[model samples]
Target: MNTLSKKNDLIDEFDIIAKFFTPLAKDAPGTFGLLEDAAILPTIDSHQEWVVTVESIVCNVHFLPNDPFELIARKALRVTLSDLAAMGAKPYGYTLTIALNRDLSDSCYLLEKVSHGLTIDQAEFGIHLIGGDSVSTDGPITLAITAFGITNKAKALRRSAAMPGQDLWISGTIGDGALGLQVAKGILSKQYSDLAGRYRLPQPRISLGCRLSEIAAAAIDVSDGLILDASHIANQSKCRLVIDGGALPISESVSRIIADHSEMFELILTGGDDYELLFTAEPEAIQKIKQAGYELDIPITRIGRVDSGEGVDVLDHNGIKLNLLIEPGWTHF
Candidate 1:
């Protein structure tokens, strides 16, 4: 199981580790590469607790078959990293499990490109590859990542802590991920290629999350679209969230598309894959949150408020709650 022979060269999985993955484990103090079965945790503060999360991506399910391996690898890692961000944690390290298709001609080369991708992110985020597994699959190529982080023991953010007087805030713009999917599918014009880039790479709000642990009353990463993710917080907190449709922060790219095709507004509100942060904070914390966003240069928008109730409502500029057309979020099933 450790080796897969190719026509020109007989590089096995171990060689692949030596060439590509060994260096990634350097940052993790006790992980001496694939030589060991386990990895050690990142350096930690005495008062911090470990926060971990896992996510999987599959060909044609999470991404297109023709996607570059590097982008695929990066996306798979970011989704899991976003989970850590939602809890107000600092990324420590990550483990990866890749299932390669032996019959697919590109699988071997894909491993190299994916490793390069991981290398890029590891340097950018200061995380190391602690440990992982590699396997052969007869089906489509699949990869999973288990990300780890550290946060103040008792201060991790929660989705159930929101209160009636909290203001709903969102980090960064939305809808580009869905629009980007359209571009990838050829349903959209090439002029929207910028949007497609967004679908491929999501900017997880790690810096913002670290700053909001004590400030925000509740928080969640927006992976399953705005409406659905918002509903998660509202439902758990036993409160109603009134979102102003007009106040939703959208890029100029999406604003142009929705201007001519107003129907896209529903898509903007309900599309999945936008990895921005959705959170709520007390009214008194407004200035502090704004200041933090200003300092971090991450756009933080006040889009709504939490009220005493049980559901989420999206309102028009004129105060009418618009019934959106599609389901609010994405599901694996």
Candidate 2:
């Protein structure tokens, strides 16, 4: 086993992966998981390949320590599933790794609840657990999951395919997860329980993503905030992304927060963890995209456009750039 060692001190997650795990996959062709969002494994059949992604959630960092074990477990699984959803892959199965603190008397109960949560989502998404590992830890409880799916398309969607003149679109409403966190922390009113629920369980757009490979030029999940994630497409595709702030789709829960405090709009843009799909497609495919969304019963909205330039620009309805208070999205570093 490889460990991250910086003169015996641990470095950051990205650094650790790049220095340790990346080298392990050097000879493994198609195992670009370190360089890209997911790893692709070629199969015997030419038409399909395995798309695999893994993510870890910590007790206090990703979710509140005291949050329901059930919700935490669902989030742990769903976040990895969201990665598969971004690549237009169909769920197959997953492996879970849990580091538990044995000192807690309710550890068994918590494990039961987490397993129950996983069972519910597995049935809902039509996926199953293949294998996993568990161990005791004196530190905070941590959960890691490796999820894999299969895509029948000749090629899974990539973040580097967007081109100038394409339209930027998003599935489902935004800002719910960010606002939901505030609601969970009691920073905002609890009258908006939907917002809190959104924070707890994100609806991964798996069905819509499966259909989008043929329509979308590029796609990514908005786990790091809309502006930040859109910037990823911009940087990857070498095109400028201009998002219309006015065109942003907001749910009733988000609308309520904005109605009371307009400043919350910043949260809507930069707040991360929505896990919704943010994608780009040519204008000619707009009708087909909408048709697909309708068939999937998911609302798709066009809120921006790709243009010839650099970076991402967000403009108000008046077409004036709004000065941002902070960086566009969440950064682990």
Candidate 3:
């Protein structure tokens, strides 16, 4: 793979597909030989540790072809990194899997886009792209990435550790990505181009999530929409989640977009693609998060709490349950 140019043809096309990775193996299980640039598995002798996560971005499903290619690369890498951040992982490196359509002759263009995306993010996080795979197929373009980070495994935040009475919190604003895509499709207009930017290039709250691990009981990135991702944490922790409808932290810009459509709250609530972090913490930690200095342009809002039940409820300001046709957001049929 060429690191700097779009002219380098895709090479090292491995036909012998590697064996399917087990969940543990896929998680970059246990430490191994740690070199200066590559990962050196920590031992009883070494204090450093590692955590791994893998994610994929498919063209038709996760993004659109007309979407700026550079932004596409940014979104794909950010999503994978979001997963790493949720685990309180300090990024070390990443591996990519690219499946290009056979009809596309210039694999170089895709590589260049991918590299550009990685470079921008690496500058901020100090992570690197150490290795990857490139293959051709009849399917839509797909980019899969596995990112590794060093963290204390015992201290890593988990999705199943939320306790009842813990407070629920989200980083940054919600619903921009969902609304942004609508603008991109011309379903909406440039009147809300800022919203469209949210969809095309979700700024993952990486540092915030990493810091929250020090206090959060459980955490997840809001990729599958807040409703679905929150449900995952609720169900896993066996607690009921009560989210206050009005407390959702949507941008004023998104509110303007919704002003045109009236059904704005619904889209923001269920719309997927918002790569923010959703986490549960002890009530006492709420003030600390506010003081942590990670607030983005939009503020973090506390929407609900973990309760002693099995599902999530959306309540209005009066504490009445709100009616929603879409119970959970963005489920694949």
Candidate 4:
């Protein structure tokens, strides 16, 4: 749980992995270097240098086999892009690392489908596929993307700068992606299929994040479920994240689905793949975000406040607290 052991574990993995290539890093670079799409390299001509981030997804873990190829590819790219968006970075290019199970690689049909999926995402995002590697593996298919982006040095947003009393706001709704995965797996009935789609294909809030660049003090994409991701922000900023569950914009469609399968709400809470922007800003900046016509279609809902507390808590309309007793969201082992 401590940072040193966590890092040493990574170095151990990299040592095993370096058999394939030169050790990509020597000493690890802290959290952002530890996660995200790619490390923010030190710049010489610093004014025009770009921001970078990377993300990875694995089959049987991040996606179901029955998921469409296009959906899978798009999701792979969007998830990484979500990190860039959270940093208010502009799209530049990407590098891919695709590892296929021997069975999948042997099938031309499957390969073509996966390739087309990557093609569509690259074209839509205007990102060039600069380079990448293909490797054979015995495990499930794995797709990793490292997206490079540019931003004015002054405009970049990060997870470590939030202040106390800042308002917490989220772009789009939460829980849909987790619900979407359930629907995809047939765990949820067909009547609730939309939730399934959300999981398979998440829309990275790129444009909106870029627009709010100047205002947002701290930001992150909700990938490993809302509760865990928000906890990340709180822990990093050293502030308590108190979320109003009543104000949570649970979609009507999701509410209807919930009526039938009540347990699904827990799935929504800890569900991953909701690539929306969860951010904090000053009250004045928040009002500016509202009036600036940035969130044209996406709803930026203010669900809570950041204060001096230890962890995350949810409250109802009457201010009564609710328990999210479940364990934390996704953790890579």
Q: lDDT of each prediction vs. the true structure? A: 0.87, 0.83, 0.74, 0.73
Off by over 4 Å in 3: 1-48, 294-298
Over the stretch 303-327, how does candidate 2's per-residue lDDT look in tens digits?
9999999899999989998887488
Query: Ten-residue segment with the worst summed lDDT in candidate 1?
Result: 1-10
- Spell out the clash pairs found in candidate 2: none
Give Cα distance to truth, residue 84, candidate 1, Å. 0.9
Candidate 4 minimal-lDDT segment of 10 residues: 1-10
Number of the predicted model whose TM-score against the real structure is largest: 1
lDDT tens digits by residue: candidate 3, 1-333: 212122335443231112211111233423221112234443522554678889888887889888877788778778888888788777776776777776676665665666666667767767656556556666788888888777765778889998898999888888888888888888887888988888887776667766776878999888878888899998899988889888888888887776777776787888878888888989989777887644434367788999998878889899999887465788767
Candidate 4 regions off by >4 Å? Answer: 1-46, 292-295
1-333 per-residue lDDT for model 4 (tens digits): 111123111223333223221222223232242233344444435575588788888888999887886678778889988998998888876666766665442343554565567667766777655545556566777888888888887788887777888999998888888887777888778777777777888888888878878778989999988889989898898889888877887877788888888877777777778898989998778677786434467788898988887688888788987775476577777
lDDT of 2 at 1: 19
Ranked by lDDT from best down, the candidates are 1, 2, 3, 4
Minimum summed lDDT over a 10-residue window in model 3 is located at 15-24
The positional error of residue 181 in candidate 4, measured at the CA in angstroms, is 0.9
TM-score for each predicted model, relative to the true structure: 0.96, 0.86, 0.85, 0.83
Best-to-worst TM-score order? 1, 2, 3, 4
